[model samples]
Target: MTQYRNVILLALAQACFLATSMTMVTFAGLAGIAAAPDPKYATLPVTLSIVSTALTTAPMSIIMQRTSRRFGFRLGAAIGVLSALMMTYAVYSGSFILLCVGALMVGPFQSSAQYYRFAAAESVPADKSSRAISFVLIGGLVASFFVPTLWRFFGDLFEGVDYMGAFVFAAVVVACVFIPVAFLRPLEEAFDVGSDNAKEEDARPMGAIVRQPGFIVAVVNAALGYAMMSFVMTATPLAMEICRIGEASPEVIQQHVIAMFLPSLFTGFLIQRFGLFSILLVGHMAFAVAFMTALSGIEVMHFSVALIALGLGWNFCFVGGTTLLTRVHTQAEKGRVQGLNEFLVFSTTGVASFAAGLILNLYGWQTVNQAAFVMLVIASAITLVWGMAGQLRARRGRL
Candidate 1:
């Protein structure tokens, strides 16, 4: 297992694997496909796509246990290809509900893609895990660059043909994920399906493990950070669209997404230096900063920096929380506990994402930012309580 492990190839595969997330950028196409029959369902495509992934992630994990990571990823990518094709068919037929169903099928593929970072970590030593994870994240960052471009270019390509062009473009991105999943050299020490259950006895129930403060803190820290970021970032696009600050210039939105992913470049190293809790604290403060920066109004420059700061803050908290959560469980407990944690964490993000659009449309801007701040505060309070309780327990033990 002393392989040098070509980090570069691993990183590229992850980027390509993650590139499928850009399907959301194809919203215009989905919109056109749905607009004729059901205006209420116009946003359903992007929304349901996430819900689809959420529902399937755990089942996909089980399948991965029996299959090689390579094989599981291949299946996910293949489904992505199918989803893209289905999306094209939906567009051709102007089937709004079919587009949503296609989205549902797309979720498992994304669920499989979620493991790419873990694959990257397993490729290297413990010391390099953070770096490897960050390398994979680079893929996410790079997609932030092209997603909007794909959305816009494809939106323009078909013109009066409607968003079908964009749907077709998304299909191309889904197809791209297939090549990497196909050609990726499976990590040298990643789970071998045959040897996986060697320690099945060590598998603890989710309830018993999540009871640990470390586990609780890690999951909450993660869920809260994501929920808060989603709460705010979800609103920001609409908020800016309302203010007309950068709505006319689409580059502004593209730059905002770039800011979100760009900070990921340094998050792994930062976590290594400052410790996970420190990063968590910094993330809260950054969220606060992002919210405050937006209070002045949605100017392009103001929101641009705010969005980027928000994105970076999210990266630190999320990556830190993930790393810490990994530490709190044994192999036996890993599946159940990790599954539970992600379910809750992503559930929070989904609520926040959904609420962002709904709340912004209803209550206006100030209410949205204020709501995000409140969630951030609540999450931070939970973190502080966990840390303080741990310290008190340690002191009492000495007595």
Candidate 2:
């Protein structure tokens, strides 16, 4: 269908979005440190970006549902251009508060861009939904490859400001997505009933949807997976600097970003072959591995290995949880559920991001990893119980 072709275009657009996102993660904390009022709040900008994304999640979903996805995409990109420009001025003028505002504005752009995967799912058959979602995310591989390189290429574009060039280039990259969305046809909402014949009885209440076992597992895995990953990743650069591991900090982040998306290459196939439960279990295990490795030392190799594991874990949990969510919701419920899911996921991640610098400064690197380890264990335990309960129900049905 032509919608599939549109999906490809959206995927390209997703690549551009991820490129901007990765750059933010890579430099936002460091930038915050450069101009923050207090050194301890060095990650405040990054934390605010996440908090902003969380706040925008539901509103963006509502906008897409009421209008066209294309409209939301374009609106988001336009805002992105504004945000990037603000960031540019923020860095150039060395204004910390302005930088936070810019970061906060990025939330809407990210909130809209995140739906690319769901939009891809709408483009294909239900059976191929997971594959389509993965395909859209595969665009991140482009960002993974180019974001750090671009950061370096443009890091010194301004004579005195070190990172201002990066934001300038980021603005240009965000503008690139606008052109693709302009030429594309909007994908229709698949599950919602038309307003002409709308029936309140047909739509399930939010509480009912939230109570589903599958929904609980899906939200838990994705939210916690994201929170755990953000906790450690946000603090890595600062920790690297404290350890005097200068140039290698970006390299470590680059590797972590690459690892995060590389698995999207085959994750859909894994979901198909092994099933969501198995993949989720493995995802939790991957988080465990990352935490354990990080606790082992403060060496560059240790951080590198731990982040790689964290990346792999996030992919499996996030992708698997998202795909599983598709099975539970009807067309009408998509916007509501996805918005709530993203809000919870990003909000908790915001907390984790905010805590990262404080914990790293107050306690130590090992303590940060220790906290991540505890969260992972709880998430893993909950997932296991959910999976077992599902199996028991299946068995009872057979009997």
Candidate 3:
């Protein structure tokens, strides 16, 4: 019961963390356009946020390793409160540079929040880790609803400057997260970090770990899935506006966010039943569907359907990748391995997000979908080949 309670609280914290992150996703690019010196740099703030996360991933993991998860989480929540205030001031001051700086500061907060899944994994049995990870991510579904609704309701509170109200509301929501996070009591037995008897024999070097077929596949699935999803998602609103479908852009983004997380309700079960490789294959298939759907038309429905499929694809790949990662590294190596994985994943995403606006502005929406398709193909091919090799190795071991 205590374990489950901890997971629940982490989930709540995840919800608040996402509400801040997603709300930024919802409005950051548009706000950037309004504040940026050049329209081409409109998405820079969003990209910087992702870049900041990538940069801070390693340090945050190290902090958690040296301290307690609760301590780390509390630290992140405090930063989130500070970032929210910065965001409020950024919008109110009408400074694009300040907004970009605010976005940059929020990166550590989001990076810290990403550890919620790993923390949830720590609270449960090993076999149930996937479900625990998924359960924590399910909080994103609630965030998908709450964030946009929060934006819609409070977005206009400042009358002449609506983004200010949204940022202020985001600040309040983030402040509330500190409460749930402060009370969390993680299972002490799960972490093996401080024990003097910890065996060095079982732990492999980072190079050897990354060279493993499973590790490579896991990182590829996560990085490529995240990058492609961010690529399209970041550009979706801009593309919709280009298509003169701007009015529904917010709702479209909301639906896409929901789709990204809605699958968490059952993705872990599917991974357990079908195996991680199979689920990863299906995730690629989902991305393929999204690409095909995007190419089919430029209508609002087409964009909606494509983004929804993209969301489902991201959910499966990310969850599958994280699950696979757990099998590749031992307890002592988790901090380094997870930090490296996230750094790679968000670096890929940050680059893709920064390029998204440029691609949209230079080429068009079709080109963006085409770029996503290319990445999907590359990831799927690599994972499939790696899985086959692993199977062959397993067969030889059995014989």
Scored by lDDT, the top model is: 2
User: Residues 93-129, candidate 1, lDDT per residue (tens digit)?
Assistant: 7777677777778887788888888777766888988
lDDT of 2 by residue, 1-399 (tens): 676786788888999898888778877888888888887888888898899888987778678878878888888889988999998899888899999999999888988898888777876778988778777877777666777777777875564786797798879999999876776654643233245444456779999999998998899889989999999999999888888885677778878988899998888789999889999999988998998998888899998999999999999999898888888877667757877887788888999999999999889898999999888888888889988988999999999
TM-score of each: 0.83, 0.90, 0.89
Residue pairs whose backbone atoms clash in candidate 1: 29-163, 203-332
Model 2 scores a TM of 0.90
Clash counts per candidate, in order, are 2, 1, 0
lDDT of 1 at 44: 48
Pairs of residues at least 3 apart in sequence or in different chains that clash in candidate 2: 191-331
Evaluate residue 116 in candidate 1 and report its C-alpha lDDT on the 0 to 100 scale.
80
- Quickly count the clashes in candidate 1: 2
CA deviation > 4 Å runs, candidate 2 = 1-5, 120-132, 186-199, 329-332, 393-399
